[model samples]
Target chain A: EAGVTQFPSHSVIEKGQTVTLRCDPISGHDNLYWYRRVMGKEIKFLLHFVKESKQDESGMPNNRFLAERTGGTYSTLKVQPAELEDSGVYFCASSPGGDSPLHFGNGTRLTVT
Target chain B: SQQGEEDPQALSIQEGENATMNCSYKTSINNLQWYRQNSGRGLVHLILIRSNEREKHSGRLRVTLDTSKKSSSLLITASRAADTASYFCATRDPGAGSYQLTFGKGTKLSVIP
Candidate 1:
């Protein structure tokens, strides 16, 4: 089976611009998660989706960031008025749920200049 | 905030040798998982050990969890150059009320051939 796939492996945008990252989870997986790793920092959770419903979005950093999992098959993360500090690698993962391991995608590396 | 802390931050081992990395988490967890990421690649799940499991092994990879100490260790036997990558420990905390895994600042392992 194909693993989780992310779009635009690398993205570069200017500060104050908007950027969106996409993730397609593995088939039959009900749980999708978003995480990011800033330079010199640990990977932190952003949000989670369970079949089109937002399960946990407490990890979202600010209002400027938005995530949606429409149809529960794929997810998109958008950052409006992006700041230089928002540059990082955004990773998407999916699982069958209930203590199962997650399958991750090759993250989208966003560079805000 | 990062819940799991990986020791050594980095590691270097010669081929045919063994590599061991440790992770300590702050909260009670249901299970702990280890992942590997090669340069410019997505994270690949390596192993998972439940709170009730003391030791689990798959091929050359071995994981041990000590829930009492809130710590876990990953051991890679007969390391090869291909094993060179960043190894991360992620914990699934039950209290977090979500399936999102809390990751640590990974240990960068360099396997010298």
Candidate 2:
């Protein structure tokens, strides 16, 4: 089975610019999630999508960040007016269900100067 | 503060040896999972052990959970050089209306052939 795939493995942009990260999960997976890891920090949960609807978004960092999962097959995370702290590796993951194990993508390394 | 913490931030072992890493969480968790990332890339699901289960194994990977202690461990037996990667432990706290996960600072493992 195909694992999760991410695009634009590496990204670099100046502060205040916007960046979008994409993730395509495995087929038939109902649970899609977003996570990020800062340098020397633990990975963190960002949000979760059950199908086309968001089940939980408490993990979102701030208002400038937006996420969407059209048709629930893939997901995109957009950070507007990105700050220096936004620089990190953003990962997307999907699972079969709430109890299923998650499969993650290689992640998109975003560099906000 | 990090919700989860892993001891022995780094580990080194020879081929045929066993690599063991420990993780501790502050909150009560519904489940704990282990994942491995190579070269800071994507993560691969290693194993999952629910709160009710004390132990689980997949191939050479063994996971043990202790709810009373709020800790977990991952043991990789017969280590190979290919096993070099950063291993992380994530915990899902089944809090009121909160289903997000908390991850620990990963343990970097190096298996020398």
Task: Report every candidate's CA lDDT.
Answer: 0.93, 0.89
Give me the runs in candidate 1 sitting further than 4 Å from their true place.
Answer: none
Residue-level lDDT for B31 in candidate 2: 93
User: For model 2, what is the alpha-carbon lDDT of residue A88?
Assistant: 93
Candidate 2: tens digits of C-alpha lDDT, residues A8-103 = 899999999989899999999988999999998889888999998898998899999999999989999999989999999999999888668788
Residues B3-111 of candidate 2: C-alpha lDDT, one tens digit per residue: 6788779999999999999998888888998988999578887888999999998999999999999889999999999999999998888882545668888999999
Residues A39-64, candidate 1, lDDT per residue (tens digit)?
A: 99999999989999999999999999
Residue A96 error for model 1, in Å? 1.5
What value does the lDDT take at residue B43 in candidate 2? 86
Model 2 clash pairs are none
What lDDT is reached at residue A35 by model 2? 93
| Candidate number of the best lDDT | 1
Local accuracy of candidate 1 as per-residue lDDT tens digits, B3-113? 788987999989999999999999999889999999999899999898899999999999999988889999999999999999999999888868889999999999999
The root-mean-square deviation over C-alpha atoms between each candidate and the true structure, in angstroms, is 1.2, 1.4
